[model samples]
Target: MSLFRKPQPITVIALRDAPDLVTSLRRALETATDAERPGLERALALTEDVAERPDAELRGRWVRRHLDAAGYEGPADSVNAIRVLRQAEPGLTLLQALTYARETAAAENTPL
Candidate 1:
C-alpha cells in the first residue's frame, strides 16, 4: 500500500453557497479541540465576510485577503501573483496557491 494518500480535488463552490459552508464549518468547530479552533474560526469569518460583500471578483478578493493576512503588503503585486498562480494551477486550493506564490515571490525578491 502507498504511504501517502492522493491529493483530493478541491471544489470551487459559488459564493451564494456560503451559508451552507458556514454552517458546516460551525458544526466542525463545535467538536474541534482547541488546536483546531483558530484555523476553523478564521475560515468561518472569511466565509461570512465574503458572503456579505457582493463582489463580482470574489476569488480575487479572497486571494488578496489571504495575502494580506500573510503579511504580503504589495496590493498590485499580490493580485498579479495570485492571478498567475490560478492560471497555472487552477486546481490549487487557496492555501496551496498562496503558499507556493509566497515562496516564489520571496525567492524572486519580489512582493506578493
Candidate 2:
C-alpha cells in the first residue's frame, strides 16, 4: 500500500492580520507537487491581490470569501484550523503549516 495517497480537495483561510504570512505560505505551496497545489496557488494569487487592496476590512473579508469559495467554514483559530485539515485529508502526512491550511480549506464547507 502506498502511503502517498491521492490528495483531497482543500480550502485555505487567512485573516487580514496575516496576509504576508499567507503569501509566504502560498509561495511555498507553489513548489509543492501535491494535488492541492493548484488550489493553493489560486488562493495565493487571490490573497496577494486582496492584500494589495487599500481597505483592511476588505482584505480580511476577501480572505474569508476565498475560504468560503474553497469550502471551509471554521473560525481562523490555529487549533481548529489544524483540526479541520487533519479531518479532511487522512493521507495528508505532512505537519507543515501550509499543509494544515490547505487541508482545512479542502475539508470544510464554510470559511474559517
Candidate 3:
C-alpha cells in the first residue's frame, strides 16, 4: 500500500543520569540572546554549585533542580516525573527526558 518504507527509530544508550553542565551550557550559549547570555554565563561560572548530579544519588535535588528550572512550584513527584519522562520519547537520554518532563509538567500544571 505504500511506496516508501517506514523509518526506523535510532537507538541511543545513556551513559549518565544527568546532563553535562559545561557541554549543555556551551551549546545553549551558541544561540543565546543578549539578555539571556549574562545569566547563562553566570551559571557557567558557577557550574560547581549548579552542576547536574546522579539522580539516584540525589533524587530530591534532581527533582528540585528540574522543577525550579521549569518554574514549577509544587510537591516533588520524582517517581512520576521520571516515569513520564521515560514514556515521553524513546531513545532520549535521561537528561533530555527529564527536561521534557519538567516542561510538560509545568505546561499541564501538574506536579512531576
Candidate that would win on TM-score: 1
lDDT scores of the candidates, listed in order: 0.64, 0.54, 0.55
User: Over the stretch 1-112, how does candidate 2's per-residue lDDT look in tens digits?
Assistant: 5677775453333436547767686678968878878877787777777677544344344444544655777763355554544455444434443454544344444564
| Best lDDT among the predictions, by candidate number | 1
- On TM-score, who's better, 1 or 3? 1
lDDT (Cα, tens digit) per residue for candidate 1, span 1-112: 4547675554433358888899999999999999999999999999989668543245445555555665556642475666655665578755556655554454446344
For every model shown, what is its TM-score relative to the native structure?
0.37, 0.30, 0.28
Give the per-residue Cα lDDT of candidate 1 at 93: 59
> RMSD (Cα, Å) of candidate 1?
13.4
TM-score of 2: 0.30
What value does the lDDT take at residue 50 in candidate 2? 66
| CA-only RMSD, every prediction | 13.4, 15.8, 12.5
Better of 2 and 3 by lDDT: 3
Instruction: Rate residue 48 of model 2 by lDDT.
Output: 71
| Candidate 3 residue 90 C-alpha distance from true site, Å | 37
Please give the ranking of all candidate structures by TM-score, highest first, separated by commas.
1, 2, 3
Worst 10 residues of 1 by lDDT: 53-62
Model 1 C-alpha lDDT versus the unseen true structure: 0.64
Error of 1 at 34 (Å): 0.8
Model 2 lDDT on a 0 to 1 scale: 0.54
